[model samples]
Target chain A: MKKHILTGTLTALLTLGGLSVPALAGPEDVVVENAWSRASIGMNRPGAAYMTISNTGDEPVTLIGLATPLAMMPEIHETKTNAEGVSSMSPAGEIVIAPGESIALEPGGLHAMLMRLQEPMTEGDTFPLTLLFDDGGEVTVEVPILSIAARGPED
Target chain B: MQRRAILGYGAAGAGAVALMLFVGWWQVDGPGGPEPIGQRPVALTAMDFRLTDHEGNVVGPETLIGRPTMAFFGFTYCPDVCPTTLSDISGWLDDLGDEADEMNVVFITVDPERDTVETMAEYVGYFHPAIRGWTGPEEQIARVADGFRATYVRVPTESGDYTMNHTASVFLFAASGRFVTMIDYHEPREFAVPKIRRALEEETEGAT
Candidate 1:
């Protein structure tokens, strides 16, 4: 009887603290959502993945790199267009997310460039991706491959 | 008296229908629609450069002159923008249906170092069958880009590799080899198809 009461009290305390459900959800403080990629055009072509990373904890976290079995080298890249409407892509450095903030990796902006894809990423395919953090921790996400003309996760 | 009242309502209804028709025409052809930036067509003959197509045939601006042309500059390595644009072009062509055969669509490479003839051939094959991939010497690419007033630059990445920065607009030209207008990147198909149709119509009228 006492053990049961103690367990009930602990659950009540956790619920009152507003950390019961979400705290038990994942071990990492960062949350990755809407991970998606477009289908590869053809063989020997590269691919890209986009997602939104949210730092749910009170401390800031840094995203250092990415990894996937599908690509030879998965790197964070960003596409920037100039004032004259010239677009370019370059490797992106470490991304820092403050507590309660979210960083969106989207089209025409920061994204994961999958270099030298092992095979063509076909539509209706899903793959696992790992996001390496600065503190040696990582988060794994499932990325879904959409149509080549897909503009976002919703598509 | 009731019959006259009914006739009066019918007359008002017809007048309203006519007004709506006029308003619709005004929206389509008036200042609301897309307007050509340049009043005069820029002659493609003014530019002279040679590049090889994906099929390994040497082609110059003269080859593009006889048909309504839609040209874009991008590299095969481009993952997001280039592929998306190519897919959008395919959708546009699909929307055009049989009329697509009346146009010349070309994909010019800004990164000549990586996009060889073979690479371009494989890359373009994934898109609309009508698209012709072109690549050649860097200087010749520059010559063609200058003729179109398009710009490109090489940008180095942190990984010691490089990428290209180039104009994102698709240039449209009439069969007379004259510049008609530019279709901005990510422009919706509803607007893009009409621009292409206008270019094609310009050619058809010229032929007549």
Candidate 2:
């Protein structure tokens, strides 16, 4: 009778352990946070998007593409200055997020340009965006629309 | 009787000639000469160049003609100096009331990399919507700066970032797009306003 009790206890413990495996798996390996865009001005105005990308996986991830409902095309850009005192902006091939590291996209630096808006983006509106990673994974986030003067100091 | 009349006429003519000579001598010695101001008037003329505006519009020296223009060079990310100068100019314009309508204020962004036409349009609107901002292809911008004798250099920082050191003078252009004078960043209002006023008056006088 004692040997039969030991076998039943082992079987119960194994079943309980199997049920908790999903909990240990947690969520996705790559996370995107604080995704936002500078608000658009008028119907003809263009807007820019900014965000922070954090990678939790052991392998490095590359951001190969981006998309937004507001823009016809989304592109990653960097500002470059030449010796002749002119400023120009060009496309960045890819943004790499190393394992256990975060990359920040901010003003006056690397940022995503939301080109050719379908409609005007007004203040207090939120736009949906999706970012595509090189590993065939994607994340969706909402970008808050703000006034053009939002980031500037009060007059 | 005829001889006496002739002698009186001769005496009157001699007295009139002598009076004219005395008046001319006094006028030469009086306040008609130049003032005793220590320095001679320096001609503040500058050369012209072609550049592009925030709308990618081609603008040349001719754009400033027909109005008194105030031109300043600064960057969009400048934390203090650039904004303050622009704000002050806006306030000064407010004080000028109807006079401001005839003036044109321009802000040229020194940082071309970050100040695209779209960025400049947004940045310039923050100060005052009336103030026009100009940025161009790198070569064009450099040519304009060099023509104005403005100096700008980039210094690398420890973080691999860099800062630009540039001349901070605000240039004044006449109605004909000729350089009239310059107001240093630290020029007092007592000095600057009067000079600007004089330039305006001169422009008006020329027009009339």
Candidate 3:
């Protein structure tokens, strides 16, 4: 009974406080670089996060999940534009990263879609994000918020 | 004998239809066919329609005329395309150097349900300083969309959430509010910058 109560309290606090998860633990094969998100305009607005994901491991790995406390829901999505210049977004599932290959989650392409934003991603703010791998390994890291108009870090 | 006669008539009818179609196509093609995408301005002159700008001012097509304009249709909820296209426009404006002052870019929301005037202001605030966002009642927005031949719809997802899928092209207009051409979404800086320069020149030429 005591354990259940403690866990419940912790979950509630995490959700209410918008607590970012603790830093990633040891032994991560996937290196996440330059994880950043553009500042959202208002509360409850949607936002996007981008980063470069590199696979240093010898074997291939597939990304299966993502989580963030800043958003009520997080999803992996990709935007595609046709020849006629119409754009559509679709859920991207199981993105496989080949060994020695790097995949970019950038603007106008694959991205982490943050829905029902719980907090404003203001400039100079930072948040925690967790990525789950199909092999049961997870990477938790800090995403430094950038200006809303930023096209890249240089901007 | 009757079957043979019927067959002959059918062949004659088919020949007649084929000749008519060839003549019709020759008339429509007009020598070298229709003009290229970036050349002729189609005069897509937008009809006057009321809309609330990000600055809370009531505006219409007439309010935006007399300047080289680029009309873009999108929503704030768009994650990748909208921001990317906005960034793309910013780059073109940057390349335009001092001439950028003579151009106007308008962002009209197709998802007015969520994109209020306040939100529209906040969203466009991220792009180039010259870009402005507009939003209004659904019927008014629909009229403007019809004027530009743009399309957008709220698409429902499997998870019960929704997204706004919209035309991603940037509609270019001359100083006279005549439709010039378009810079398709994700168009390379090299392709868009030249066309923009020419359009600005056209605006200047028309002015003097």
Q: lDDT scores for all predictions? A: 0.81, 0.63, 0.78
Q: Candidate 1's error at B187, in angstroms?
A: 3.5
Can you write out model 1's per-residue Cα lDDT over B120-202, one digit (the tens) per residue? Answer: 99888877899999999999999988787778888775445666788877889999998998887756779999999999999
Per-residue error at A65 for model 2, in Å?
41
Per-residue lDDT over B32-149 for candidate 3, one digit per residue giving the tens place of the 0 to 100 score: 4544323433454548689999999998888767888888998887777888788888888988878888888889999999899988887887788889899999999988876776
Residue B100 accuracy (lDDT) in model 1:
98
Order by lDDT, highest first? 1, 3, 2
Scored by TM-score, the top model is 3
**Which candidate leads the pack in lDDT?**
1
Each model's TM-score, in the order given? 0.71, 0.46, 0.77
Clashes of 2: 3
Of the pair 2 and 3, which is ahead by lDDT? 3
Runs of candidate 1 with Cα error greater than 4 angstroms are A1-33, A39-45, A54-62, A96-103, A116-125, A134-137, A146-155, B1-42
Candidate 2 lDDT over A1-155, as tens digits, reads 45424433443343334321111111266565555554554544446767676788898888887788788767776544334322334567788888999876655456776666787777656676667778776665555665544432122
